[model samples]
Target: MADLSVNFAGISSPNPFWLASGPLTNTGYQVMKAFDMGWGGAVWKTVGEPVINVSSRLAAIDYGGRRMMGLNNIELISDRPIDDNLREIAEVKRRFPHHAVIVSLMLASDPTLWSDMMRRVEDTGADGVELNFGCPHGMSERGMGSVVGQVPEYSQQITAYAKSGSSLPVIVKLTPNVTDVRMPARAAVAGGADALSLINTINSVMGLDVETWLPDPHVADRGSHGGYCGPAVKPIGLYMVSALANDRRVPVPLCGIGGIETWRDAVEYLLLGAGAVQVCTAAMHYGFRIIDDLTEGLNDYLDRKGLASVQDLVGKAKHRVGDWNDLRLSYSYKTVAEIHADQCIGCNLCFVACDDGGHQCIDRLPGQRAPVVRKDDCVGCNLCSLVCPVPGCIEMQDIDLGLVETWRQRQSRVGF
Candidate 1:
């Protein structure tokens, strides 16, 4: 069997899948239950001075049959007392000795407060600590979350404080609210962080309740922007992870988060250079039992690929990622839309899309039997192929143009 276990920043876990800090890890009971159900690790909900969350703190975006495609939350950190959380952490670690238990911490940027909290949490026997500088809403307003994370200097300073206060490995969780993610990532590494995790939710507002003329999840007919997560944020997370992973300047293990719901998603993150990954919304929507299929599916995939362990797959695709300028301008793949005679229903969607939006490649009228791809006008953009409802009905056939020269080579030959 391929080994799914991973050692992320010196904190060894049974596998790369860890329950991200959120509603899922808010209590010892929940954490323990998740471990029992096979989650390899858990980052305890962000702990700080207790908070009083509002009644309507969560709002979601649903697309037709898909519910919770994107989730927004105005919720704060763990509202439980610090002592109670510490006690639970101690107990959970004692019981699940082999599992990774990382305590997530957040507080004002005061060095003493951060250092003291780090020291106190380290005493709980947890595997490591994740600096919660990524919360984008409630905590940010309080000057504790993305308020500090958005500033590279503040992130570096807080990371230093955590490192100073504890010997335990420190993983700095980053917010995606900034223009450039690499700046903060480099800052965390410079401040002595052993590993990095991202992305904490993006700041967003779900739709407004147009009938009532109020924002969604309104407390009093008005709602504030909140942190957004779920499947919609996966692309953003993958882009940031790939950007950092490809940058050799910022060297630190990454625990990818945001919109990871399955084994395939986990594999994508790992191949993009994440040492491991964390999940929140999936566990929030489904249950911790999702880990069963997540693990089994990943294991099966690795076996089929003849991989010995999950570690072997990490960063496998990192080198393949490149800057836009590095792309091959010379290589050309000209494919034209080909319609299957027997399969065409003459929906005319392809013709309409191509004529109005694409290269006017497909020729069809209201009573036409089928859409024909006009070879000369076809740019091979595949727009017609995409809007077609039936699968295999519209196929893009490649046009083999013999040896080709790149723009760069052609420019050199002209010698401007």
Candidate 2:
């Protein structure tokens, strides 16, 4: 059996699935309940100066019968008293000594406040402290949250303050709002961060209600832009995580967040260089019981892959990610769509898609129910495969062109 345990940036946990800082992790009851259900760790909801959150705090986008394909929220940090949060943190850690209990924190820009908060959190006997610089909604307006995360200088300065004030490991949670995520990632590392977690929710406005002529999750007749997250954001999260993972300057363990719902999603993060993964929307959608499947599925996957432990899976695919310029030119390599005729449902969805939206490579013969792929014209865009309802009906077959040259190589050859 593979060992599911992990020691991430000095914070040991029984596994790599930790509940992200959100509504689900807002209380000791919730965190303890989640741990009992098999979660490895929990980052307690961000604690700072308490603020009253508005009603109708959440909005979601559903697609194809999947609820919350993406979730958006105008929610702020924990509204509970700081003293109450601290007491619960100490109690939870004391009870679940082996589990990772990381307290997420945000504060005014004052260095003294950061230093003091760090000391107070450390006294709770928690395994680590995560600087909550990634909340993208209400907190940003207050000069905290993404305000600090967006600027590399502030990221470094605050991380330094947190590190100086406590002996506990400091993990900087980064926002994805910037043009390049690596900037703040490197800054956090430069400030003595033991690890990094990304990406926090994206800046977005969910949608507008046409009937009422109001934005989604409206507070009466008004709505504000909120942080966006969920399965829909998985691709963005993967790109950002891999970007940091492949970079040589940001040398620190990563805790991947955003759009991770299942063991497969968690595995993708691990392979892309995350030491652990954080879940928010999924847990909120499915409940804490989902942890059982998360652990079991991961354990089974590790065993099937012949891996000894979860750590062995981390960064295994890092080398596969590279700049687009490094990709082989089309003349050097290519793939064409191959439609399995026997399996085709004759839906012509592929044909419609290829003709209308993609390259006009798929043709429907007069006498045949299945469409034929004009392989020579097929650009291997995979649009046909995506539109096909049947799995494995359309396969992209690689064609070895007996040549190998990247864009950079071609540029060099042409002396451009």
lDDT per residue as tens, model 1, 1-416: 89999999999999999999999999999999999999999999999999998878888888879999999998889999999999999999999999999999998878899788988887899999999989888888878899888999999999998899989999999999999999998998989999999999999988886778898778986788899999999999999999999888788899999899999999999999999999999999999999999999999999999999999999999888767544344244467778886899878898899889987777775556887887877888888889998999999887666655555555676752
Evaluate all candidate structures by whole-model CA lDDT and list the values in order: 0.90, 0.93
Model 2, position 175: C-alpha lDDT score = 96
Best by TM-score: 2
- Measured by TM-score, how close is model 1 to the native structure? 0.94
Q: For model 2, how does the per-residue alpha-carbon lDDT over 33-103 read when each residue is reduced to its tens digit?
A: 89888899999999999999998999999999989999999999999999999999899999899999999
**Estimated TM-score for each candidate:** 0.94, 0.98
Could you tell me how far off, in angstroms, the CA of residue 312 lies in candidate 2 after the best superposition? 0.7
Number of colliding residue pairs in each model: 0, 0
